[model samples]
Target: MEPGAHISARDNVVKHDRTDFEVPLMEKDFAELLPRGKMPLANRLPVLNLFNQAVSLGGLKAAGAKLRQDVIGCNETKIVVVDHGTGLPRSCIAF
Candidate 1:
């Protein structure tokens, strides 16, 4: 992750403005966003790596954890909301 973008995310959280995450929390900011210099071949939410999440964070509770505003707590986890549900094509990706 970029130092600037990463810290900017934390700063936004500190200020408690929680709605600007259209893509930063999902698509482009996770990668080199288009405006960062290179044009994207396609704009899409990056797929969730289930294997990675499984290894790193194991099972999630039946209910998702809350969306916390703690910038420091961000290092541990950032559960935005309970997931949409199972079997939907796009539901698996969280950011």
Candidate 2:
């Protein structure tokens, strides 16, 4: 997608919903820099760590549910307690 395009989790794994940031280079700038060796310089733009929050939450919830189910299915009686105060919500941990 284009640099300023609106993106969502359903569109792809990368979430680009945020529009409050700026791109250091434009298409014209890139075209001009192609002749030089610095066209795709790594330092030209800031590094961003983007993730899909919805996909992450869904995976976590599924894992938690599977863990709870497996623990309950054990033949030996064991007390399984999950703490919900680390960072995730209580509902997520309770799954």
Candidate 3:
């Protein structure tokens, strides 16, 4: 990759408008989501399960999802909450 080289990416971009929202889940829906014996109980666990638990417990927004995307050669982690089909940033604590 050169600094001034011209490159084209047809459909290589994630076109997300402010109206993009993530799928929501609940705690009771966990069993249906995880495969039998597939749910890891090890360190850190899985973010998906934690997400479900949070919404069910009202710790996190019920219509939101966590996103960790790369931006400007850096990792931009944020919690995207659903705001009527729009993805809004609940909080973005960069380290």
TM-score of each: 0.13, 0.20, 0.17
Model 2 residue 24 CA deviation in Å: 38
Regions more than 4 Å wrong, model 2: 1-55, 73-95
Q: For model 2, how does the per-residue alpha-carbon lDDT over 1-95 read when each residue is reduced to its tens digit?
A: 33222333233455554444556565454565464635565445334323433344456667666777764543225443423223212222222
Candidate 1 — what's its lDDT?
0.34
Q: Backbone collision count in every prediction?
A: 0, 0, 0
Ranking, TM-score, top scorer first: 2, 3, 1
* Leading candidate by lDDT: 2
Candidate 3, superposed: residue stretches over 4 Å from native: 1-16, 26-28, 32-38, 42-95
Minimum summed lDDT over a 10-residue window in model 1 is located at 83-92
lDDT scores of the candidates, listed in order: 0.34, 0.43, 0.37
Q: lDDT (0-100) at residue 51 of candidate 3?
A: 34
lDDT of 2 at 10: 32
lDDT for each residue of candidate 3 in 1-95, tens digit (9 for 90 to 100) = 21111222233245444334445556565565665736656443533334355223232333332322321223335333323222333344456
14 in model 3: Cα distance from truth in Å? 9.6
| TM-score of predicted structure 3 | 0.17
